[model samples]
Target: MITFPKDFLWGAATSAPQTEGAALLDGKSPSTWDKWFEMEPELFFDGVGPNDTSNVYVQYKEDIALMKKMSMNSYRTSIAWTRLLPDGKTLNPKAVAFYRDYFEEMIKQGIEPIINLFHFDMPWWLMEKGGWEARESVDHFAFYAKTAFEQFGDIVKKWATFNEPLVHIECGYMGDAHYPKVHDFKRAIQVGYHTLLAHAAAVKAYKESSQNDGEIGIILNLSPVYAKSEEPADQEARHKADLIYIRSFVDTVVHGYFPQEFIDLLEENQLLPETQAGDRTIFEENTVDFLGVNYYQPLRVQAVENPRFPAQSPGDFARYYDWPEKRINPHRGWEIYPEGMYDIAMRLKKDYYNIPWYVSENGMGVEGEEQFLDAQGVIQDDYRIAFLEDHLAMLAKAMQEGSQCFGYHMWTFVDCWSWLNAYKNRYGFYRLNREQNYARSDKASSYWMKQVIEQSGFEYGGHL
Candidate 1:
């Protein structure tokens, strides 16, 4: 029998914009997502946009009761900035009262609330002002952080300043994958720097303020990069990939400074952004008390003599290459190697002073729900169970090796709105029925996860 430590945190994660459906209610202003859905609904999959989400804003009480049924001791959720401060200036009393009630209800149900301040839901007003790329936006974020801390700090203890800052930089600025898409390396670097600064500023505000018992941190989606082969070129490519994807933000948050290699890369390519005199001090002075790691997949890279682009020349930029064929995950597009999670944890333990950390997000995304359903309206998601079991085994091995991993929280509890994919990829333990009263049904994986949460660990059960 594999038994976890007594203090293990077993919970599920949900972001406000993804789960909350009352997008326009309670004096809520338009967030970037709200605006994007209105202007370009074509970007969404199956014509299902952000406004029509899980409706958890109004159904949270029922959801909490479901969580109790799953025996979840903790729950992770984000606070929509627009919902809290409609105009991004004045605080919305209704919003505050609603969240306060929510938090108090969770506590009353014996569930710990892990509140995240931002989860890719930027207010449209701020985005119009250049978002994280502008220095003024960082000040606005700090103000928002202070406002949230002062208002909800009495009940909420675990605070995550930002969720997946690297994703925002890479997807929104460097690549055209996410909303407000632009392909400018220099702007990406600037946005990345300002994001780190914003996180540090939020941490500083949380620490200096009257919230003494609250623990503050940031959520990072750490995708461990691997080389296709043992060749020197492949190894070099792996290092570059790691620097670009993982270390740039990890070093800044963990060590309170940017990685010198990253700075050198930016400087060499003439892609370095303008930095103020006191920016370094702000970053160095305020480091997080903990870390939230969202591990989905690994990245496989290979060296390239001259990276190719569709355009002739997009100015000086740091470029590496991807070898998609060398790595594979047939089930999902992402590369699935459970060992990567172990390597990430061990590396963090060795290099980053073994900071207190937890698996904030890890799960499988299936294309459809038919594979898991029976004729009697029950869904048996055995594949998801196997996927999670493999990852949990890796996490357990890491824990045995002295990695200070506090707990594991899956990608979500119920099917929620995925940004651009809309509902293309479902990653939930509970199957949500869009047709029938937004009714939720427990999958086989959900039952398995409940047992795992009760046991806190897994034993050898080969393909059970």
Candidate 2:
């Protein structure tokens, strides 16, 4: 049996806009998502919008009970900025009361809550005022962060300022798949720099707050970069992609400064983000106490000969090279390489001073999970079980070699609504029965996970 540490955290994760159904209720204004979905209903999957979520805002109590049933000791979720402070200036009393009580219930049930302040759901007004592109959005986000700390910091000790800010930067600004779609690389870099600036400000706010007894960090989807070949250009491609995608955020958050090489590259390309005088001090003074790494796949690339996409974007830095032998999650079209986990841990151990971290998200999202349901009505998700086993075993090996990973959170607890994908792909311990008003039901993986958590380990090679 590969056992984990006694105090290891085991749970799942969720975000607000993806799960909370009451998009515009109780003084909650519309987010960019709400506005965008209204503008282009056809863009979403199966005609589902943010308003048709899993109803976690109303079903959180029952969801907490479901977590307890799954033997989860912790859960990572985000506070909807639109819900808590719709206008981004004033706090809603009802929202504040609901969050306090919600967090209290989770804590009371022995499930520690790692509450994140933002999860890509920008307020509609803020987006109207230029979102992360404008310099002023940084200050607005800082104020919002301070407000969150003032309101809920006492109960929510493990605070993450943003979840996967990189995705926000790349997808939203680069004309990819998010809101305010624009293919402006200059604005993208500005967004990236300002987002980090806002992160530093949030960290500073957390440190200055009275309830400063806990850690403040950022969750980044850090994918390991691999060279497609031994050629010098391919190796350069790997380094460039790594710097742009992984190190650009990890180094700033952990090492407390923007990478000089990346800065130089941007400057040489005339893509450097405009910076203020005192911004350097905020970043240098308030580095993170820990980090949340979200791993889904690794980057395999070669030198940019022919870019993958026509637009000039980050993907152009190192064009993806298809590897014949790479295994892929056919449902999601993402490569499946469990070795990336070990690589991530070792890199953190060897380079980042072995700072505290956790696998904030690692799970498989299979299309049509209900097709796996057996005669007993329990979804037999053996594919998901194998995915977890492979990743966890790799993480265990990394731990034996001295990786400072504290927990492992699956991508989601309930098959919550994905942003544009809606409920097309399911990644949950408990399947969300959409046809029956999002009723929850245990899956075969849930039963298997309970045994793993109860035993603190599992015999993986044998059948359960």
Candidate 3:
């Protein structure tokens, strides 16, 4: 029987906009997501936008009972910026009370609460005023962080400043996939840099707060990049891809500064972000106490003859992006390589002082086309179980190799609305029926995860 250490944390993760339903209640203003769903509903897949997803804002009591049923000892959830502080400047007492009560309930049920400050839910007011690209938004974010620390820090000790800041840069700024869609490489770099500065300012604010043992950090979705071949061009392509995609955020957050290679690349392309004089010192001195690593899939890179520039470019010889040929899961259309987890852990250990870290979010998403009718009308999700098993085995191997990895939390607890995909790719142990007032039913993976949590490890051929 494979066993994990007794102190290992077993939990599930959920974000506010994805799960919570009360988007316009209790003086809570609309966030960018709420505004996007209202203005451009057609942009979302399946014609479903974040109206009242899973109704977790109201059904959190029942959700906590579900967590208890799953034998979960830990849970990760993000604070809705607009929910806590409308207009990103003023705090809502009712919102603070609701979260405090919810957290108290979780503690009463013997579950540890891991609170993340921002999960891509920027307030509409802030977005209207230029979002992260503007310096005022950074100051507003620092104010929100300070307010959160003062109000919720008494009970919530584990604080995460931002969740997957690189995703915001890549998808929202560089690519047009996410909301506030802008396709400018320079703006993406500037937004990414400003995000790090905000994170550092928040960390510094948390350090100065009255909470003595409060731990603060940032969450990064660290996907290890691999070259397709041993050719010089392929290797160089991989390096460039890593610098742009992964190292830009990782090096800055962990080492408190951007890599010189990345700066040189930005300079060569004339895509360098605007930076103030004291910004470097803010990042360097205010590094996080821990890191939350979200591993989903590895990026496979190959040398490209001509890289497509999302922004206006001045070069003809600039290389483009290409993916390495790899096996992808039929259900999710993502590469299923478990060794990427090991590579990520090892890279963190070798390069980032081996700081205390945890697998904040990792899971599989499957389009459940064939819905099975179990006794309670549950869908059997054996594919998700298999995905978690493979990845967790890699995590166990990394732990054995002396990586300072702490715990693992799946991507979500219940199937909720994804940003643009809506509910197309379901990544949850429990399934939610959006039509029936967001009714929830536990899938087979829910029971499987319960057993895994109870045993603290996986055993082959043991009733999954």
Candidate 4:
């Protein structure tokens, strides 16, 4: 049987907008999502929006207790920027009080809290000013980071600058999945570059403060790239895909600079983002102390004959091709590839100075999960259990091969609202009952997770 380190952390993670229901309550202002839901309600699934979440705002106490019962020693959650700084600058006293009480309760229950600064919930006021593409937003975000550090840095020792920075840029600028739906490669690069700047700025602010000595990091959703075949064309296509999808953020945050080839390619197309003075110094000086990896699947790239967009953006030089024979998660429409977890770990070990890291967000989402409910009021989510077991085995293998992985926090604790997809896909241990006033019910995987946490390892053939 494989055993994890004695101090290995096992918990669940959730973002603010995805779980907290009070979108505009208690001196909280509207985020980009709040404004988007009002303007385009039909785009959301089941007509559910940000305001209709797990109501963690009012039920965090009970939620923490549930976490305790589940044997979660660490709980990863983000503080909504709008909730803390209603206008992105001014502090909301009520919001501050709520978070202080909420975090203290988690600590009182002996649960370590990992707080993330930004998690796709941009304040509506900031988005109007070009969001991450604007240079001014960098300083604005730095101010919020400083305020958060000063306020909660004592209680929160582990901090993350941003969660899935690439997702916001891809969904918002390069694709139509998020707000300000503009499909422009140039704008996407600008948004991505400014986001890295904001991260570095936040790190700078955190270090400048005379607060408690704590750890800071960034969470990246790294999807390893693979070529469809050994053909030169496919390999070339895969290289470009890696440059855009993988190296774009990983290289910067880990290595403190953009990939040289990526810069040359963008320069060739004149899609380079506007930059300011001393930005390089900020990046060089403020690198993350740790990294949080969110791996879901790998990208299978194949050369496209008649490329679109002049090979300037993702899916232009090469497009993702699904392997038909590969295992698939029918519920969420994503490939179920556990090997990608090991690939990510090895890549970090070989490429990024072997920095300490953890699996920050990895979980499966199933639609119509209520159908799995049994007579005992528990959801028989054996599929989730199997998924976790497979991935954990792979993670354990990576650790054996010398990967510095300290924890594993699944995508969420309780089934919460997802952006755009809404509540259509459930990725929580505790199922949320929509008809019964958002009641929480334990799923089969929840019990399995409890054992894994308490034992600090999952023995082969142990209660499966």
Provide the overall lDDT of each model, using Cα atoms, as 2-decimal numbers: 0.83, 0.90, 0.83, 0.90
Clashing pairs in 3: 306-320, 307-319, 307-320
List TM-scores for all candidates, in order. Answer: 0.95, 0.98, 0.95, 0.98
Model 4 steric clash total? 0
Candidate 3 stretches greater than 4 Å from native = 307-325, 461-464
Winner on lDDT (1 vs 4): 4
Off by over 4 Å in 2: 306-311, 462-464
Where is model 1 more than 4 Å wrong at Cα?
308-331
lDDT per residue as tens, model 2, 1-464: 87899799999998988898899989999998899999998999998999999998899999999889888899999999888888988889989988998899999999999999889998999998899988998888888899999998889899999999988888898875899888888889999999999999999999999989989999999889999889999999899888898889999999889899998878767788899999889989999999999998888998887764433677667888898998888888888899999999999999999989999999999997788998888999988898889898899989999999999999889999888999999999998987998899988888888889888988868322
lDDT of 1 by residue, 1-464 (tens): 55668789888897998998889998998888888889888888887877789988888998888888888888999999998988878999999988999998899888899999988888898999899888987888898999999999999999999999887787888666676888877787788888888899999899888975879889999988877788887787778777878888889898988889978866766778788989888998999888999998876667666754421222212233455443444456776678889999999899999999999999888887767589876777777787788888888889899999988899889988898887778888888887788888877887888888877766657532
lDDT of model 2, residue 92: 95
Q: How close is candidate 4 to the true structure, as a TM-score?
A: 0.98
